[model samples]
Target: MQSAELQGILPGKLIHMLNLMRFNFNVRFISVLSLVN
Candidate 1:
């Protein structure tokens, strides 16, 4: 109930936050990969 309501109103904001988190994660992953090479 609450999840659906928030999802309805904040879909764009949620996606933006998720993208930022994924980007930060990818950056960290790449740095670690580079260090191993």
Candidate 2:
């Protein structure tokens, strides 16, 4: 496998991971806000 091929694949994987983290963070933020109110 070439470095070029690996580079092409890594960003898609990283983006997927980031999206999942953002979703979980948003859920926690909303729950915290509700508790404070």
Candidate 3:
């Protein structure tokens, strides 16, 4: 939900792409962490 909001506010420029990429990376990281726990 929060990630989706961030994506909406961000532009499609290079920096925004990086932001979205980082957001995706964080989501994946959290999912993996939860599975590990």
Candidate 4:
């Protein structure tokens, strides 16, 4: 496959991974914030 094709797929996969990480982190943060409030 071409480099461009790999790059195109990479961002989607990276974004999904990032979103999952963000979701987990956000949930933890929200819970902590609620406790502190």
RMSD of each: 4.2, 1.5, 10.7, 1.9
Please give the range of 10 consecutive residues that has the lowest summed lDDT in model 2: 1-10
How many backbone clashes can be found in candidate 3?
0
| RMSD score of candidate 1 (Å) | 4.2
Superposed Cα deviation of residue 2, candidate 2 (Å): 5.1
How does candidate 3 score on lDDT? 0.87
Model 4 poorest ten-residue lDDT run = 1-10
Error of 4 at 26 (Å): 0.9
lDDT of 2 by residue, 1-37 (tens): 6999999999999999999999999999999999999
Q: Write the per-residue lDDT of candidate 1 for residues 1-37, one digit (tens) a residue.
A: 9999888879888899999999999999999999999
lDDT (C-alpha, whole model) for all candidates = 0.95, 0.98, 0.87, 0.98
Q: Rank the candidates by lDDT, best first.
A: 4, 2, 1, 3
TM-score of 4: 0.61
Best-fitting candidate, measured by lDDT?
Answer: 4
Q: TM per model?
A: 0.72, 0.72, 0.66, 0.61
Tens-place lDDT digits, model 4, residues 1-37: 6999999999999999999999999999999999999
Instruction: List, residue by residue over 1-37, the lDDT tens digit for candidate 3.
Output: 9998778766556677898999999999999999999
Tell me which residue pairs clash in candidate 1. Answer: none
Would you list the clashing residue pairs of candidate 3? none
